[model samples]
Target: MSDKAYDDRNNLGGRVRRYARVGGSVGGLAARLAGDRLFGMKIDRDDHAMELAQALGNLKGPVMKVAQILSTIPDALPKEYAQELAQLQAAAPSMGWTFVKRRMRTELGEGWRDRFASFDREASAAASLGQVHKATDTAGHALAVKLQYPDMGAAVEADLNQLDWMLSLFRRYDKSVDTSQIREELAERLREELDYALEARHIALYRHMLADEPTVHVPAVYPDLSAGRLLTMEWLDGTPLMRFTDADQETRNTIARNLFRAWYVPFHRYGVIHGDPHLGNYAARDDLSINLLDFGCVRVFPPRFCGGVIDLYKALRDGDEALAVAAYEAWGFHNLSRELVETLNIWASFLYSPLMEDKPRLINPADNPGQYGAETATKVHKKLKELGPVTPPREFVFMDRAALGLGGVFLRLGATLNWHQLFHDIVGDFSVEALAARQNQALAAAGMEGTVDGR
Candidate 1:
């Protein structure tokens, strides 16, 4: 091969090697955590786990992003794993100037100087996979540039392999629980999430889908600056969702309404779901509109599934077991025996409790026994043990995550609203056929031309 060809091969080989190294580290860390927990092995579980999580967090690549996703979505990992991975949320170490410059030069041309009026070397925010920097284009449009770390796909795949091993260890440790569904769910979404180009398009799709919803915001994409690894968009300014406590009741309610639309308008109205529910993904502007960020984990479901969701809500409210069963079956639960069905109802009831009630939504601890969250987890584990493994068809994973993520935000705001009524208003005209038609139209317009049958 020529010298240039040899250099290209060598660079590719280096990337593969680095990915393997990180993958190996992930497996090693899981083993260490397991040994400490299981055998009463003289290991400081907290300190050691924190160290391992920090190491991955420091990497700030695909592995770290996966960890962050697992952290926020409860039951994706066992309790200890979730606890450790949760740290990755705010804990990812930012990339330094050296790496940032290298990445920018590669993404833009070496003379890419003319593209931007100014680009900040320092990152404004850092997370598991990439970092965002505030910049100004030559056209003077203030923008946020999300730059992926080089070779994130390789890192993600390697880490996922390690994560599979880690989940197997978890199953061994807790035989009562089968996490096959969670594993499948995370794996599929993580793959889609690794593509920044897909994410960029997701933003554009949302912009058009939610065009009339003033309370929710989606940033304008700059296609000229985006690629599979990099994204540039209009920078949105807002306070973090966590800061809602400082706002008053009306402000909180307004924020919640926007947040409600931010989360459900796509799924309920357009059949697309923003899968990542981390509190960081949304913000409340001074104008009271909710600004959504991070489109990497979008999950587009069959419109039938959304209709099934609404039907399920109606069933729970009317105490119609048959309707509930139809909805669950529609959502892809197979060979669901009567016992399994009943067991599921216990869990479903908790999830749909807000929608079932005639009163306004109040996520107060006083309202729930805190029993549903933990106890339902235990019950599901027991059922999985006895009734054979259950795989929660791929689509529900992110829907569940988004719901909890939004719930967490609501809990933070301590805002109460008539959730049942709002839900009814959205789905009152509920027809799976209509939803499918609208969704198909939206997807076609966005160049995502395909039909999604519930099956």
Candidate 2:
């Protein structure tokens, strides 16, 4: 491997440093939980959960990202933990210019500054894994240069170990949702996010999937200036989606429609999804169009899984028990009992409720937009506990996450629309065979053939 590539991997020193940091921050919670479990001592879960969130929040990398993801999934973590972790943002403090200069030099050599007409010393934005710097290319075009933080491979490995321990501890206390598959799925995606070259391909794949989508924008990547740890792409000018939350109803609805198309059209047609639907991942233009950012957490699904999503929706809508069973089976759920199916349906119906109604309505009529799915999630969690453990298909992790994430966004916007018709407009003629064919064409066109199991 190249020296530059070696620098990104989990070196001995980096791994040690990461472990020390994570363990130092969270070791107290681990000891406390262990005491509670072994000695039958009672501890204030809410307070401990907050302490754990604060601990992870202070750390950088996939641990924080994993915490945020777990917070959204129902029963993945205890309610108190989820509530506190949900407050953790995808962002972190930016690295200094000295660090940025060294990173740029590592990515593009010592003369890296000459490639740009002008590059900002300060990062325009920062996130868990990387930070974005605004710059002007030699030809005077605007660009966003995303530089991956150093030793992320070590960080990811360390954080994933911590994640497994945390989940295992939770499992010892509660057996509602089996998190083994969730850990594996998150590990694969988190590792993938460390590779900017793979992310560049994801960007290409998204561009191919949404080429005809005029209302949604995907930035064009600059191959010459990009590297495994660095990505340079066309700069998209837009405002944060949250900024429009207080806008007029019509404006909010238009933005909502565009956001819906941007997220679903790719999944419905190409069998791929942008799994991280965090508000910061997208921005809205004055024209109401959205700029979809951060290609790292994308999921390219098997064609059958895509069909299964639609099948389950129809099964719930038409009250077909057998079809629901088949749909769940298609999604990799097996040996499901009648009671389990009924239990699963409670959550399914809640998700499909918005899509079932033909008239315009709010995504959730709840007064507190932030608590949109909390109650339903709690109900489902209770049922799952009674039904025993269910190992959710790995694919279901992000699919459910995206749904909940978008639902929260819609609730925040207070956008009203005929969701049933909007959903029908995309899946009116849905077929697994056609979807597979389209997915293959798009993947091939984007030079991502075999990178994902299109079948």
User: Which candidate ranks first by TM-score, i.e. highest?
Assistant: 2
lDDT of 1 by residue, 267-330 (tens): 8878888876656888878898988988888888887688788878778778888888888887
TM-score each candidate: 0.88, 0.97
lDDT of 2 by residue, 1-455 (tens): 34453376888777888889998999779778767876788899889989999999988788899998998888898787788888888889998887788888888999999999999999999999999999999999999999998889999998889888888888888888899989898999999999899899899988988899899999999999999899999999999998989999999999999999999999998888998886788899989899998999989899999989999999998999999999998888878999999988988999999999999999878787656678888998999889889999898888988888888889889899989989999999999999999999988888888866525
State in Å the error of residue 287, model 1. Answer: 1.3
lDDT at 366, model 2: 79
Among residues 3 or more apart in sequence or in different chains, the pairs in candidate 2 whose N, CA or C atoms overlap within 3 Å are none
Among these predictions, the greatest lDDT belongs to: 2
After the best TM-score superposition of candidate 2, give how far the Cα of residue 102 lies from its true spot, in angstroms: 0.7
